[model samples]
Target chain A: MNALNRKKEETFKPLGSKSLLSRMAKYRFLYLILAPALILVLVFCYLPMFGLVIAFQDYDIIGGITASEFVGFDNFVKIFTMPKFTKAIINTVKYSSVQLFLGLPFPIMLALLFNELRMIRFKRIVQTISYLPYFLSWISVVGMFSAFFALDGTYNTFMATIVGESYEAKNILTDAENFLGILFWTNIWKNIGWNSIIFLAAITGIDPTLYEAAMVDGCNRFKQVLYITIPCLLPTIAIIFIMNTASLVTLNFEQVFGFQNIYIQEETEVINTLVYRQGILNAEYSLSTAFGMFQGAVSFALVCITNFIVKRVSGVGIW
Target chain B: MKKSFGEKLFDVFLIVFMVLMCVIMIYPYLNQLAISLNDGTDTMLGGITVFPRKWTWSNYDTIFSNESLIRSTVVTVITVICSTILTLIVCVGAAYAIKKKDLPFRNAIIWILLLPSYISAGVIPTFILFRYLHLMNNILVYILPSAFTFYNVIIIRTFLSSLPVALEEAAYIEGANEMQILYKVILPLCKPVLATVALWTMVASWNDWTTTLYYVNEPSLFKLQYIIQQIIKQSEVVQKMVNDSALTGGSTSVRARPTSESVKAAAIIFSTLPIICTYPFLQKYFVKGVAIGAVKD
Candidate 1:
């Protein structure tokens, strides 16, 4: 038996040790099919990662990335000193925290309410209407808001009726103080139904027997929801919460840029818009790149940390 | 079982609240439509709610007549079609390749593709790369950069793996090669997921003005959303449109002088019409797509 095993191993060794070229040729069709996507990602995604070296350089348009002078940590130090950069960070935290506190619960509540609906047809119609805004781009949402909140628009007119001609028309879209509130509310409005989908799906996946068991135990509908439904949804909620926490520093660029104006730039200047202004508008490429790298590093660290905690707590995470 | 009085009250309150929420969701679009249809000159007076006081087609007429607006609409349509098709082909192919368990370096290929989705090289690096490649200010910038999304590939691959292996094996036994098997057997089974991804790509492409904002400089390559962005951000674009209307005074009637507000509303409505028209029919697919994405995550 030992001699026969040895012979079998020796016979299979040559096939297992076949050269890469022959193996590649054997799977040429698979490789051929994958080449375009691989090449595209290499050029557009991977190659640019090498270009991040400019974040440590004094990038000039004429000299470009290759000839740019190496500046080491100077770009990072410069951005750290900039008040605008500091303000951007603060604004990002403020906006994201508001979104985290208020914006997060709205969807969960909406999902719970949706699950409580007895009429399927009405529920479907409401859900369809609610998800409509998520499909529209931020540009469209901003455009619609601009029209509705223009100086002489419907909002002002409605205010005038309530205040009886003492009401001065205000452009809420451009109100610096109200901008964060607008961001919070608009986010909820746009994403409440869509974001509730996971929670709703979780609700559906709750074992029906648990509900029947609760009914036998004389638990009311609300009690059943409180005891069984909420507990069941905790895992899904924790996973989503971790994801959201990970993205706390990264504001949606499109939404911020669309809603931003000169009047509200001070309030709405996020890291993303600041980067756009510095890099694209002012052509301060290195400074913007450094800032971008800082944002990326912080976001990655946050994701890793949150993912670790969630995995430890629940044994499930984004990984 | 019969509902208690409290439950009955809660249901009534819930229905009313939901109805109110639906109104909040929908009324903005209705208001915009009313503003768009209202006379451009009269919209400045500001009481247009759900219906136009003085109905006119001049806002849309102005939109159609403006050369830049028309060009942008054409550009958006072309980009949407080209990018959606390219994305479907690239993502489907990549997914199929990755679905092969014995494919050499399969795990390595997946990591290479997916790492970018989480850890990006940031915006400036990407912009510089585009500039170096001469994709800046080029139309290919729109279609190429977004053609191979890792998330879409993962979604497609997951769907493909869920399909029974016997289907592909049966085709292979009939003398079908890998490509033929993929084309003849696998492609037919992937319609639902493909439709979901296709809709997502089309909507994303149609609504993307950022590529134009960051890369393209040529006025002719400006997309619908970017033009609308300009109209909103800079009063000059609206002024330019008004001036263009005055220049083409012989074509349009004098009664339809477009105000900045009405023109902005009209431009917004024009861009949003495609989504608003198709979203109800496509809502289920989007919901399913989100569910699939959630399950994967």
Candidate 2:
């Protein structure tokens, strides 16, 4: 009996371990398909993250990652001491907060206003035209703005006709005082049309019977919007608001970078521009990496807090 | 419901406001068109509103006449096509793998891929790494960096996961392999999301100029948007030169009346025309795509 049991155990030994291996082997081709993307993410995305440790070191180009001496928090100290870095942080916060406070409601308002339109053809036309600018590259938009705002350009001519004073046209883009306003309003202009899309979808999704009941109760269009439409739109609005708040620390690098020039650099410079200048132009690897890590930490905290508040309040969140 | 006087007045006000908004939206492009078609010298006289004051194709002629424009256009075409196709393949494959529930290390792979979207290594580390790899000035710079847009992958994954699992189950029962079930059963059902991803990839690749602004110093590899940007910058510089010379009363010997204005306008139109034309069709999918992408878990 003992000899027979020993022969059975020996026979089953290879099959026991090989079964798990075989299950994974069955999905081998799928993994093969995913190999290229995995490699790209590792090389392009994950490797740079490992490279992020250079933020702590006194990163040197000639010595590379291995030979760089450890500096602890020196890079962060340097970043905090640099006046330009502080200005960039302040500007970024200022621009983002203004955009959050002022620019958040325009799209929803636009969506509601458009929904009130009875003429379908005209509504479609308005939507099409509104969406057109969203497709234009920032370079193109900045170019157009620069040309129109030139001293001898059409804007000045039109102003001359209206005000009858041929004072030189204001270079609004370069004016330090108008920088935040310009950024906010142009963002609204470019995105309001596109941003209203989800709101429109939400509006359409609301039951028509709610409006019918409101009408039976003698509610005017304005009252209907206030009582019915806004309440129904709040969930969508809450989600969007929370999502946007999460991104409040980050600016669109291309949008600001394309519009930037030496004249307006002081007013328009933000964290991204700072990173670009220090990292690419000056090759201050450790300092710029530290700055990026700082921005990332702040942004991550903001997103987490917003997500928590939103989840608790509205029962919907980014997660 | 019968309309009240207030309702009628409100409708009128709304219509007027919408019409005004449309005009504001369209006038910029139309203004550029008018300036581009007008004689470059005449455009300097100002007030070319919706239509050209003096019509000519010379601005477009000048832009097309440049050899760099043609080369850039060709380069743009090659990059957009190659990059879009490559991105779609990479994203779709990974998204497919991620859809499988029992795949080994699936959660970890997902976390790694999605990490970059949230936390960046900043410009310095990425630049140094890419330079080390010698990807600068190479066409791979455009294609490889964007090979996996994790956002698009998430969108596609959400779509694939939402699909009924029974279809794939039946295929598996019928002795189909994983690849077969994916290509034959799953892919056919992924049209809407696929279209959305494709259009997005195409638009992004076509519009990108920052890659060139950062890495490409070789004129031969200049993309269309980047070259157009250079033209706009040159025109601005020459415009400044012309303005300065005129101010100094130095008898500015200008060549061809500084046709830079109309040329820049023409370049704007040239670059944006294709996107404008393609927008209406893709608009159908994007509205739904964005909503689904945002609201889904």
Candidate 3:
């Protein structure tokens, strides 16, 4: 029996226990597929994160962060005291809500409408043209809008024609108060169509039989949409809402900064543009660092709260 | 239980309303096109013109003549090329790594990378970090933080994990190693999803201007969007003066008179041409890429 067992063990050893390393070698191609992306994340994403240490010190070019003063929360304290910081926080929250309200529903509405179009050609054309605006640079859009809104430009031209009185254009760009609302609406015009892609997909995924049954039951198109479409899209809507709320303080910097003016600073200022002006332009590294950390904290909290609520209500949380 | 005439009227009205909405959506773009192709003189009249008074290619000619325009193209092209390669690399690696159902810490690593996308670090800290690295003026400005969009990875990973694992096992059984199996097996199969991701990353990079604002100051390194933005601002100032001169003298400089709005229209077309031209052929890919928002961020 011992002789038979020894021979069997020896025969199995060569094929089975070659080594754990050799076992992983069998799946080596899987690792190779992953290599390029892994290395890039390390160099760029992970590398910059290590640079986050600059958040502690008074980071400067000539002095470098290490030799510069480390005032331990002083930078954060300074950020809280800045008037512009408070204004930016308020404007960001306001703009974000407006974005959520106006921007969020538009795509879903567009998708539902497009899905209902009886003519495929018209649907394609509308979808194509609507999506085209998404590709246009915010700068160009703002430029075209400024042209239309100018006193002698298109909007006022139409306005004067209707009202039978000449209205000189006020400097809307330079005016501080009206800037944020304009920013919010322009964002809607720019992003709504592109955002509709997800909702469109979610629409297509709805079971056709459910629609057929509803139609047979004497439900019209609008009723079917209210009952069938919106509820089916609830998951996507809930997700995007939470995502939107999570990043509420992070404004679209390109759009805001492109359209901003010194005179309009009170209305147009966002946390991101503020960071650019204060951190890069002014070189107040400590103040900028603290401000950034504060922004990060608020956004993080928002995300956590959103996740908790989503988990409790919908059971579809991102753990 | 039968249908009512009021309901039918409402349905017809809704359809007509939608058709009109489509007309409105498309009209502005056509107006811009007409203004672009028109000779400078008719455009500055600035009233709505369905067609150009005198059509000419001169507006596009102006864009082609300028060295700054060409320079912006070069900068924009390089950023797109380098950034696309970088994005594919990071997203593929992370996606591939997280794909293994039993891989240790896979979920944790994915969650870490994902948190950044949802909860931003804000512009100030990211800028400060860039400043600290002395990368403030570097072209790396456009490349680094954006290279690894988490949304792309999750989409790619989801697509990859959905593939037949049997093909991979079959290659392994044939005595091929991991590299051979992956190159000969998985990558060729991944063309659809990869193409989807590539198109999106390209558009994102091409339309980028905000990154160019923070990380770069050199005119030579400015992306096309930034340069186009500069021209828009310049034309705005120049056109305002032309408008002023026209009001006073009943005439304006020959170049500024016909060129300002016409050229402005041309520039918009030029900036968007690459996307418009290439996008249709790849529209099928886009439906799949919308999976980007599905995963998160």
lDDT of 3: 0.72
C-alpha local distance difference test of each model: 0.88, 0.82, 0.72
Candidate with top DockQ is: 1
Q: iRMSD (Å) of candidate 1?
A: 1.3
Q: RMSD of model 1, in Å? A: 1.7
Question: What are the runs in model 2 whose C-alpha is more than 4 Å off?
Answer: A1-20, B236-258
DockQ of each: 0.78, 0.58, 0.40
Please tell me which predicted candidate would have the highest TM-score against the true structure: 1
Please state the interface RMSD for every predicted structure, separated by commas: 1.3, 1.7, 3.0
Ranking by lDDT: 1, 2, 3
The window of 10 residues in a row where model 2 chain A has the poorest summed lDDT is A165-174
The worst-scoring run of ten residues by lDDT in candidate 2 chain B lies at B249-258
RMSD (Å) of each candidate, 1 decimal? 1.7, 4.8, 5.1
What is the per-candidate TM-score for chain B? 0.97, 0.91, 0.85
Ranking by TM-score: 1, 2, 3
